[model samples]
Target chain A: MRGVSLATPYLHIDLPQLRINVRRAADQAALVGVALRPHAKTHKSAEVARLQLAHGAVGLTVATVGEAEHFVRQGCRDVFIAFPVWVDEGRATRLRDLRDQADRLAIGVDSVESAGNAGRRLGHTGIEVLVEVDSGHHRTGVAPEQAGVVARAAQRAGLPVRGVFTFPGHGYGPGGSEAAAHDERTALETARDSIQQVGIEEPVLSGGSTPTLAASLTSRAATELRPGVYVFGDAQQWELGIFEPDDISLTVHATVVSHAGGRVVLDAGSKTLGADRAAYSSGYGRLLEHPEARIVTLSEHHAVVQMPGPRPALGSLVSVVPNHVCSAVNLADTFWVAEPGGLRAWPVGARGLHT
Target chain B: MRGVSLATPYLHIDLPQLRINVRRAADQAALVGVALRPHAKTHKSAEVARLQLAHGAVGLTVATVGEAEHFVRQGCRDVFIAFPVWVDEGRATRLRDLRDQADRLAIGVDSVESAGNAGRRLGHTGIEVLVEVDSGHHRTGVAPEQAGVVARAAQRAGLPVRGVFTFPGHGYGPGGSEAAAHDERTALETARDSIQQVGIEEPVLSGGSTPTLAASLTSRAATELRPGVYVFGDAQQWELGIFEPDDISLTVHATVVSHAGGRVVLDAGSKTLGADRAAYSSGYGRLLEHPEARIVTLSEHHAVVQMPGPRPALGSLVSVVPNHVCSAVNLADTFWVAEPGGLRAWPVGARGLHT
Candidate 1:
């Protein structure tokens, strides 16, 4: 909303609120005696990662080797590729380079063949491999009972098996975060048992998503938490009752372009706001100025807002909180950071780095 | 399907197929005696635009001012910004520059206020404005009868009202394209009569979408067709029975990362293969190799495929057709164009230019 002087449909961050979130997450993780490696995919800025590190975040968690390489170049010492990435010759070379650049680097592996493929190229590089366990979401990852088999396969491939991890994506829905957190701990504990039975000692049980972070810090079962969206509260977190509107640090600055047929059309649409409307999400996003407004339809560059009351006038600026902040951030090349003094642009580094 | 040597999660275009689709579209437009101004937002590649022009496309249609500037810089002389853009001081300056560079520049205006704003800034620059009429899709544009009122408003603001345009976006569903095309013609014809009532003779009746392209070729209604996704057939078009599987020219080169729970996981997920799923879309996307596979789930870097038969082995390559080609192309920086001899990289020149 403060980006009035700037153009419409630009991403901006409230630095003070971002810092508040960073400190809050680190303090909460420390209170429960669990390590915090915040996912860098949400902000995708080296500056934001620096703030997380300054607040006692252990390292960074990324989904792609390109993201890891980016942060490593930005001087991040420890990095983890949380997704079960398939390693081919090209990706192996990139991972090897990242391994050489960073102090500690790890990747997730869920299958024996992928473990073998990665171990053959990255085993000598001291890259630790974590077995991914399916908590409940069932998108990826091995079953809790199969963790031991994957760990043994990694060991046979001459790669070090670090621990087991699970993403409780189920927490993002209508089900309460407590239930998903319980399921996360259950799966991680079972996977730990399976890994220990396979002769792996003291496995690090990693689990956490933004929706489950508050309920995920069980010191007895979990060693680390990887919550991405807490730093920048999105529409999903607010609608799920996990965060307040004031906790949202990032927003898209859009303008009222059309006020026709008793509806308001904003300049921001799916391309600008990112086309990520979760089933549980209230709308495409939340209009900060008009909380009662619902974005019923989104074209490529037009957000048709259905307001409960009077809509804003044309040419006026408003802030929009995207449903999925990570996907939204990926659509922009750069974002403005609002400091105590003024705003400055920062590149969305590692954007379009899907590989 | 020929990006075998490249990495997974990269976009590749079959040049021969692209050329065939381009020629077919041009030929159809010619047979109907209508103008073809293919939307460049689908591919966003200068090479693709050049191919369309070579095949007799009148010009290019873009969605944003930044997209228009990108094409203008790439030597696309006649470009139309199809979205009803809100003109602020910053966008006005950019539009002014684009109007200066391009041979013919036009923008869509659905509201009288936005038309006045654009006309005040760009009137002297020789930019044309097209009044958008609601032709079934209630997203943007004015009602058919209100077209005259907005046309008179634009004329009063010192801007040339070039024509009336409508997007038959409703055609992109299972209701079938023929009915939507009928609605498009009816709306455009009514809008034409309204503009004529305002004393604007022979107003250009511009309308089209990929879903309605086949039925859109009526000499009595539309003057120009702006079908974007026809060049690179998407899963939505294929599911709606508008395009066949072989008509698809672009596909995502993804690799099997895991095979768990009777599902195969690919490295290309929502981040790589866009997150656009129409209600009528079959699934998240269609696999080129395994047409029976349905993309059940998508993580940041994982596309969980539920196949009826045996899944592809881990580390094997597969091609994926995204649900929306434009959104998918917006996610990649560059794509490999498979030629008769070899492949060449073409930058998605207008990537991330979502003003």
Candidate 2:
């Protein structure tokens, strides 16, 4: 690997800035009296997970059993599969094996059928099950009122039911965080009550999203918070005023290949920076050197940047903050860590582990 | 490693269809009396490159010097870097070394300054250069009128100026094949004249895209065709009527993770299927099992498929045709080749060779 200046279209992660972001999230969670389970899906590196754990993260939240297995192998004692995964025979066997490896293993089940499937596949395996409740996202999870029915199905299969969880994904919109947090609180409370009706008391209510993490501090009903993107502030978070540009720890360094016709073309494109256009996003990515410049279009390996004034010189390096850092991280195999000495390369451990 | 029935969100490549597609392109190029240089960026696999060469391809086209190096190491003799790359000192040295490895090596130079830079850095390296001409696709390349200027710069720098090339990318649009082919032919003719003015007579003229390949048969001035996506038909090509459903050799095998409401969530998402939505495309991908089903929304790991009829049962496998095959192939590390007897794994030789 070359230095950050020469490795154009490479993901440059600022270690100092990453430490600050991790500490800030951990401190906030401590002040709110809620256990912080920073999502591992954001960085997907054991090195970063160690930093989060060092900063007082109770555990790590993952998205798949494959990610859980990867982290468990890396000595992550506790892991929660935050997604409502459908467990077939193969995945069930894997999850059973993962439970033996991890000190604490929890999974989300959004429906009664899913709960039954999991319970039948991993009954009495010391795997904690969390029923997912729809807190206005409506993508996954069951209704808050239906939590008892799902918990009953898990109990019938001789499994342990821990609590309820919800993701306020709708908070990722213009002026929607406050309302989304409110919905999260209401849904978790209702789900906790329904879980009690199924004879499970003091249920662990979990809810959080990057946009609603601050609002979640006021939610007394929530006992745990899971926010992934806060650790690596992206272009979306910066534009939403949730974090400053300086807080963005990761950026894709691109070289200006063409500088003509009031436009600059960078070597970075969808394959490097990813193709995630948020509803409020102005462009595909934000250039750190020229904040006014917008990446208007992205082909497989070419990003067309519309310059505000004069374009940068050809072959010069320009840092770009991706719209979604998670997608960008997922695309890259290695990240060049920015340090005082120079740069270091770290492999993205859980990349391409979608299964 | 497993069968398609168990490997969710896996790239299933039909060997029979791929062989047919490879033979067809080679035969068409032979009939037109033009050398076929299949773009390896589509599959990024040495296995696919072998298939192309076995069917009479003259060389392989790639988007980066890294890809060219990978193919050379995999025993590909003739390789062309078809992108106007910005080469720093480190890359210039690598190019020099690569020139010694490949029997024939050429790099794209679109600007007079790039030509000058390449000439100064790689002078007397025996590396052939091709001037890129804009054929109505304004993404990159110099105007046809400016080709002589770039060629002269390269010639002055002691670099071998062998040809001019254009990618009719605008032909990807709806009903744009005929017009794009016309523009491609006109641009190449003009660029050839400009090259002749630079005292390089009989310079090779190259142009091709999957949409305009048929119409390109009428371009007598063109001596070479470089089409990438013809090897793997995608949803965009099917929508354009360029390929039938049966011609789609590559598909993402996704399992139904969630069956709820009017939608079925597939294990395949943007991370698996890729986030490439063409302007004329309808959905993220097309389901082969349910032709009417559309992949409406894609998170990092969950694809929400809106079904027109009854949803597929949970855990059942469904094949999805990605909107862009190149993007999908780039995202995958391995392709599961579906043979008549069983499945075999092939590493994507240059999956992340974006230099």
Candidate 3:
């Protein structure tokens, strides 16, 4: 594209590939009769959100209230904050305004104390609260049986107990998706049954991760799926066998600024490509054009790539598929979308919304 | 302090401590009879740059041309881009404009090919070009012996050969600073000889890294030092004995949103604290209040903290000193400076100047 030569480090998103990925994920969720509430935390672009919605996404899932606010302002009516938010007075005020703006809004609650805080602050506001149940990730969430306790606390505090959700984050590791999805199903099922036993029925169970999306089809209790990074396959997904190299929709276009010996330095570094590193990642990222090259080290503004035999000349542009595409996208201010003959710049709408 | 309840994952920089760190680095540079050119890549704030200049910084050192442009636009009279830049026609045109704006503007060129490119593009502009020599960090830079070859090439192409510069980046690892500084001296001295043998004399040899700045005093060849992280000490510096716990000026203020057993999940994550993991890091970062706490894992929006014995209550605030302060600062839009009355927000002026 014409814009490819404008800068050393720029994010490029293949519009066609991105659309295909979105359609495929939506189709996969449809096949299982589950609503596809694609996580907007990955792209953080309202444009990408619209694409997902057009591809049959029911609503959108977000990680923070800031993200929810961004999407809600962009005309997304239904939104869910997927994290166990600690809603203080300030957040409660924002939630109230968001509820007034959006048609439907939901938040996650894993503890009775936090649920009480949210309920007391948001009492009689009709804000939907989902009990987050720990499936296998052990990051945040209550035990499957403990979901009923949290839901009851929310109910007592006058907040509506809508459903339960779990993130099979352990699916990220090598070949861990199958078992994580199984744990996700069992946990969601137990959470749903426990809530039902406590007079809470018709709970909408939600579960899915990019790595375990295919396996989520087997989740009998989960009513919806929320996969974030499937929209833009990264080096982690490719290395983990979740996505093929051809499936990567986003890549950072970087210039080889320095060529010495077998190593080359790119203008892109941690600030541009993100510092997200996985245990299984080969390096910081993979050079798309030169498969044999590995970005061995990254400072704030320099990525040092080591090549096996033939290294690209200095000033040559190389596309890098980041190890984690979500964090990478969050770092950039704009994404260059491939168009007919040129690239169109789209602002990263929800960047730095870390509240 | 009131703002602590407003945002969960906000960056807090102690103004008093930051001033102290600036003064100390300047004093150290003065003691060693070297000009202090603090790297702006760490904070990316023009306000911070003014602080460094006030504390006797002769000029500013940047990692990219965009960073140089950002600071120059903010009235930085002198700037040096430390990375070996690949100046194509567009960048060269920008460089000429930058050269006109600043009293002195310099760029690094490590290879003859790159030197030729820069020389051809930037010839007759009186723009300074420093040959980058590799000390110990195998990331970038030419060998000490290759410095003359590149400098000669630049001279032959009508570009002024200023001197050689080396980054003691190998100083980052555990107990590597002293040796890396020693290597930096040897490399720069050898590079000086290599250039002088080819008729280049009185070369303004420059070298420094936060970890090796103290040891740079032993380097008789280094005429100036560029230490970026000395402005905001991090967990890596504390772990490496580069600074004490009291010296950490910047910290990520995060709230514990979930309490699950002994581990609590904070709203801060890789997006807030940065995912710069070191082999010597205790975890992702160190907590200022709870010294025994370790941020064990990070998703994009959640930091899982493993505490010993006691843990903070849910919704309580905690200060986290990141593993790498530079990367952490890059993620935030504003730095909340602690004042006598309250915290004041300062925009990160050049946060994403990665070009």
Best by lDDT: 3
CA displacement after TM-score superposition, residue A56 of candidate 1 (Å): 1.3
Clashing pairs in 2: A9-A253
lDDT of 3 by residue, B1-355 (tens): 5742557789998898999999988887788789888899999999999999988898999988899999999989999999888898778888999999999999999899999999999987999899999998887889999899999999998889889999989898888999999999999989999999879879989999899998897565699888899999999998899999899999999888998654689999888888898878889999998888888888888889888786788989999999999999888899998888788889998987888
As for TM-score, the candidate ahead, 1 or 3, is 3
**lDDT (C-alpha) at residue A120 in model 3:** 87
Q: What's the C-alpha lDDT at position A279 in model 2?
A: 70
**Which scores greater on lDDT, model 2 or model 3?**
3
Tens digit per residue, CA lDDT, model 3, A193-310 = 9999768869999999899998887665589989999999999998899998898999999998887655888989988888878888889999888877888888877899887877
lDDT of 1: 0.87
Of models 2 and 3, which has the larger TM-score?
A: 3
How much is the TM-score of the A chain of model 1? 0.97
**Quick one: best DockQ, which candidate?**
3
Q: Write down the DockQ of candidate 2.
A: 0.54
Give the residue spans of candidate 1 off by over 4 A.
Answer: A1-4, A218-220, B1-4
Pairs of residues clashing in candidate 3: none
TM-score of chain A of each: 0.97, 0.97, 0.97
Query: How close is every model to the real structure, measured as TM-score?
Result: 0.97, 0.97, 0.98
Q: Candidate 1's residue-wise lDDT over B1-355, tens digit each? A: 2433677789989988998999998998998789999999888899999999988888999988888999999998999999888777777888888888999999999988888888888776788899999888888889988999999888888788888999988787796688889999999989999999988998989999998888889534899999999999989888988889999999998988888766788899888888888887778999988888899887778888888866688888899999988889989999998877777889998998887
